[model samples]
Target: MIFTGRGRTRFLDAVTDFETAVRERDGDRAQRAMQQIQRHFGDAEDDQLAQVGPRLAALLPEVPPGPRGMVAVLIGACVERGADAAVCAPYVFDGLAEALGVAGEFCERWAATGGGDFPAPDPDAADGDVLERVGQDAADGWFTLPQWEMASVAMLNRPAVRTALEPALRTGLLDALRAVQEASGHDFKCLRYALVVLDDEPLLALHRPTGTGYLLRMTGIGDNFQLHTLLADVLIGGGHVPGQAPSAQEAAVCRNAPGQVPTTGAFNLVTPGGEWVWNEGTPTDIPVVDDVRLLVLDPPPYKRGWPAGRFFPGMPGDLVLERVLGADETREWLERCAPPK
Candidate 1:
C-alpha cells in the first residue's frame, strides 16, 4: 500500500505544521492538528473506536492504570491514520491488549505473528501444554517466515499504511546507525539515513525503496541464511545504497575498516581500539584492536576485516573508531567530546 507521490507530498506538507507544532511545544495545537490530519486522512472509524473502547474499559479493573486515555487516543489515531498494517497493527494490538487485561507475553507473540481474531484460551488446558505447543510450533518453523518488504510511498494506495516504523523489528542497518549514534553521543535522527542490501541471489535483491529523507536496504541469500549473514548483508547493503538521503556517500563508506572489515555478525564498540566481537559468541571477546585505523560504527553486523575503509573510491580514510558503551561511560565520553556550541 504505497502512497502516491501526491499523497506523499500531501503528508509531508501537512506534517510541516505538525512537526513545527511539536517542536514549538504547542501541545494543544499540535494534538489538535494531529487529530485533524488523522481525520483528513480518513482515519475516523466509529467501529474501530467502538471495538477499542469496551476492550479498554474491561481491562481497567485488573491493570494498574496510567494514561489509558492516551493509549486509546494513540491506538485510535494509528488505526484511523496509520499508513500500513506493519506500522499500525503492533501499536493498536499492543494498546488494546494492555486495555483488555491480556498477558504481555501473549500480546508480544501476537504482534510478531500479526494475529487475527482468535478464541479465548481454554481454561481447562494445562499451562505447560499450551507452552509446549507454542514451543513446538516455533521449533517446527512456525515463526520462520519470509523477510517482509516495506514498499515505497509511490506504491502505497490502499486504505492502510504500507511502511511504518517498527521499533521492535529493526534491520541490521538500523542497528548499525543506532550503535554509531549511541557511541558518538549524537542523535541519529539528525542525519538522513538509508539501508539497502544486494542479495547473493537475484530474487533476493533489495528493490529500490523510497523513504522520507533516509533509506535502509538489505539483501540476503534468501531468508533461510544464518542470522549472521542476514545481519551482515543488511549493513553492507545499506552501505551500498544511500538513496536520496543526505550525506549518504559519507555514511555508506564510513564503516569500512582495514583489518576490522565489517562482517555480517560482528559487534563493534566505537572505543579507542575498535573493539570487535561476534554478538552470538561473547560480549567481551574483543578479537582485534587497531586492526582498522578508522571504524564505521553503524549498527548490526559489525563484521571483521578493514579492507576498503572508504565507501566512495577516492575519499580519504580517517581512522575514526565508533563503539557502543554502557550508559555511564557514554555520558562521560559525550561530556569530553562535546564541541563548543
Candidate 2:
C-alpha cells in the first residue's frame, strides 16, 4: 500500500498539471493532463488508490468548474478500471454532495455513462441516533478537540459579528481543535456543547453567559444544518437542552463583566491576565494576546451552496497553526508537542 517512487510522482504531476490547465483555461493542456492522469491512475487497483487516498482527496478542492467533465471522465475511468468506491468516495460521492451546483451536470453525465450514481439521501433520515453515533465516532477518533482547561464563552449572535465570523470560524475552529488535540494527548470525549445559536439568541445572550469558552454563532451562506449538527455532536454530544439558560455562576460572570449588554453580538474574552473583544469584522492590529489560546480566520472550507461533507480535509499543519497562533506561538506549541529527540 506504499505510495512513492516514480508512480506516485507521475500521478501527482499529472493531477497538478490538470489543475493548472483548468486554472489557465487551456483546454488542450487540460485534455493532455487528463489523458496522462488516466494513464497513471485510471487503471490503478483499489488498494493502490487507497494507499494514496488522502493525497488524492486533497486535490478535490482545486478542481475548476470548466473541466469538471474531464475530471469526471478521469474518475469514471478509474472506477471502471477497478478503483475501490471507498478510495474514490471523497472525490466522487462526497464531491457530488458538496460541490453539486458546480459539478452536478458533469457528474450526472458521467454517471449516465457508466460512472457511479449520487444517491439523494433523505434529509430527515439524520435523526438523533444518527447524530449521536456519528458524533461520538468522529469525536473519538477523527475530529476530536481538547476540552481540558478550556473556558466557555457564549456571545450574542449579532448579525454583524455572525457575518464576519462565519467566513473563517468553521475552519478556524477545526484548525484550533486539531492543534489542541495534538498538543494534549486527551481524546476529548468529554466535549459536549458546541452550540449553533440560530434563533433564541436573546435567551442565550441574556441567560447563558459563557465566560471565556467556545461559544459559536452560525452565519455565512453554507449549510447551517451540517455545521450545527457537526458541532452539536462534538461539543455536547447532542445532550444540550434547546433554549436552556446559563447557570447562576455563568450569569454572575456575565453580569460582573463591564458593559456586557446585548446590542449586536459583542462579547469580550476575559482572563485573569487580560481581555479580548470581537465587535466587528474589521482587522485589528492589536498585539497577539497571550491569553487568547486559539484564534483563526481562514475562509470557509467550501464555497456557498456546497454541502459540507462528512470527511473534510484538514489544512496543512504549518498553515493551520500559523493562522491562529503566530509563528512564535506555533513554534512553541510544536516544540511542546514534539516527541523527545
Candidate 3:
C-alpha cells in the first residue's frame, strides 16, 4: 500500500460525498451514497470512525429541511447496521436529532425498548401475543434477554411476519436453518436474521423460535411496532435483487456448534468481529467450517435488544423489539474487554 494511508482520506471522502448528496436533497443519490459509507467505514478503526460525529454536526446546519430529511434517512440508515460505526453513533444520532429538531430523540424515543422503568411492560397482564412477550422480556430487568427473543416464537405469527413473506422463500429458508440446528442436536428454533423493512422509519422485526427481525430505520412520530411490521411486508420482495444498493439478504446466526448447514441461498458469512470468511455466491456453494456472525451494512443501536420500534414516552411497549443478545452474553463480551477481575 502507499503512504499517508487509507486513514481519514477514504472515510472522509465518502462522508463528503454523502454530505453533497444530502445538500442536493436527491433521495436517490443519497441512498446510493450509503453503500460507499458502509464500505469505507468497515475498513476504518476508532480514529477514522470517530470523525463521523463532527461531519454530521457540521452538515445538519448547512442543509435545508429537504436535505435534512435525506440526511436522516440515508445517513441514519447507513451507520445503524454496522458495528464499526459504534464509535460515532452518539454524534451521528445527535446530529440527526438536531436536524429533525426533536431535541435528541434517541434517548427520549427509544429508551424503553431496551430496558427501563419508563412504560414498563405489565408483568401481571395476561400474555400478549408472542411479540408482546418478547418485547416485554427485553425490558423486564430480570435478565438481559436476547434482542427480540420473542420474535423467534412469533415467526409463524403471521399477517404476522412469516405469512407475509413469499411462501417458497420462507418455508425453504426455515427448513435449511432447521437442518443446521437439527444436525447439531440443539433445537430451540435457533435462527436469527435481520429483515430490512423500509418505511419512513427504521425498525427491526425479530423472530421467536424461527423468529426474524426488521432491522428498522425511523422517520415518523407516535408510530409503533405494528407500523414497522406492516412496512416490512411492503418492502419484503419489491426491489431486492440480492446484490444491489438498498439490498436485503438473510443471515443465519450459529451460536452453538454449527452442523451441516445446507446452502440454499446467497451466502454471506462473517466472524463475530465481522471478518468475512465467505461472500456472495449461491445457496448450494457456500461452505463454512467455523462460527461467524453476519456483517451487516445497517447494524443497529446495540448488538442486543429487540429492536422493537420506538415510541413516544408514556406510550406503550408494543412498539419495542425484544432483546436479541442476552445478559450473560453481554457479560462474556464485556469481561473479555476488561482486565482480569
Candidate 4:
C-alpha cells in the first residue's frame, strides 16, 4: 500500500502540472492533467489509496484557492473509486472535513460505521420541511423553487453567515427564515421576477424594475444542475451550521468559504453571441439579443472558483465559461471580440 518514492514523484508532478494549467487558464491542458492524476490514483491499491489522505492534506496548503475545489474533486473521485469506510474515515473524510472548519464528527461516524443513510427526517417537524422537500424534489428528478428565494436560502445557509449571527429563536424554522430575509441585500430587494410559463422554458424568468433585469433569466438545463446539488446538500445535512470562522491555518486550507467570502450579489450573464458578463451586481441596459445563452442569477460566490484576490494570472470569465459551454464556440466569440494582444 505504500507509494514508492518514484510513484509519489510522478503523482506530485501531475498535481503540479494540473495546478499550472489552472493558473494559466489552459482548459485542455488542465483537463488532461486532471485525467492523469485520476489515472494515477485509479492505479493505486485500496490501502495505498488510504495513504492518499495525508498526502492530499499536505498538498492542499500548497494549492492556490482557485483550484482547491478541483483537488477536492480529485480526492473524492479517488475515494469513491477505491477507499473503503475505514480507509476514508480518519484519512480522507476527516481531513477534508477539518480543513473546512465544520464538524467532521458526523461524517467520521458515518464513514467508520459504514452508514450510507443520511440523518433520518422527521415529518412532523416544521423545521424539517425544507430539507424534506428539497430531498424529495431531487429524488423525483425535478427541483423547482423561486430563484430569489433559493438564492436567499443558499446565502443565509452559508456556514460563515450562519455562524456570525446567533438568532434568539432556538427553532431552526424561524432562524433560517429570518436569515433569508436579513441576508437579502438592497440590490436583491430591488429586483422582481416574472415567471415564464412556457412548457419549453420552465424556470425561465424576466426579472424587472431595472433595464438589466433580463440578465436574471435562467437556463433550465445549466442552472438546475447547480441548484439541485446545493439544495440536496442542505436537505441531507451535509454542510456545517454557522459558527465562528475557522482559524487562519484551517481557513487557508479549508475549501468551504475561506475568508467568509460573501455568497450573494454576483451574477453570470451569457449572451446569444457567447459573450459573458460576470458582475458583482445587476448590470443595467444590456441590449436584447437573439437569444440569451445562459443567465445564472446570484450564484454562490464560493462555487465560482476561489475568491477574487487569491490567485495569479487570473483565469478569465471566458475561460471559466468555456468549461461549461465548450471551447469551439467560446474561442470563436473571443476571436470576434479580440483586442490587440
Cα lDDT tens digits, model 3, 175-253, are 5434433332333222222222211322322222122222333322122222322232233333222222211221111
Query: How do the residues 1-341 of candidate 1 rate in per-residue lDDT, one tens digit apiece?
Result: 24443544454344456556655766676566555445444432444433433443333232222323333343333333332334334433333323222232333444455545322332233245444534433211111110001111111212122234343432533454344334323332211111221221111111112111111222211111122233333444445433222132333343332221332233233323333323332111222222311212334332343321222222122211122234454344333321211
Model 4 / residue 330 / CA error / Å:
68
lDDT for 318 in candidate 2 is 7
Cα-based TM-score, every candidate:
0.19, 0.23, 0.23, 0.22
RMSD of candidate 4 to true structure, Å:
21.8
- List, residue by residue over 1-341, the lDDT tens digit for candidate 2: 35445665677688778768766878799789877777777445566554444344445456543334235434434433344434444354333323222222323333344544222122233345433433322222221111011111111112232223343543444344444334333332212122122221110111013211232332221122233223323233323323222233322222222222211111221212222322211112122333232322221233222222211011000000111224444444333321211
Q: Which ten residues in a row have the lowest lDDT in candidate 1?
A: 144-153
Clashes of each: 45, 11, 55, 2
lDDT scores of the candidates, listed in order: 0.31, 0.33, 0.33, 0.33
**Runs of candidate 2 exceeding 4 Å displacement:** 1-12, 19-27, 40-48, 51-56, 69-73, 76-94, 98-341
Candidate 3 is scored at a TM of 0.23
Candidate 4 Cα misplacement greater than 4 A, ranges: 1-35, 81-341
Error of 1 at 157 (Å): 18
Query: Per-residue alpha-carbon lDDT of model 4 for 174-238, expressed as tens digits?
Result: 33333333422212231111011011221211211111121122121112222222222221122
What's every prediction's RMSD, in angstroms? Answer: 18.9, 21.4, 23.4, 21.8
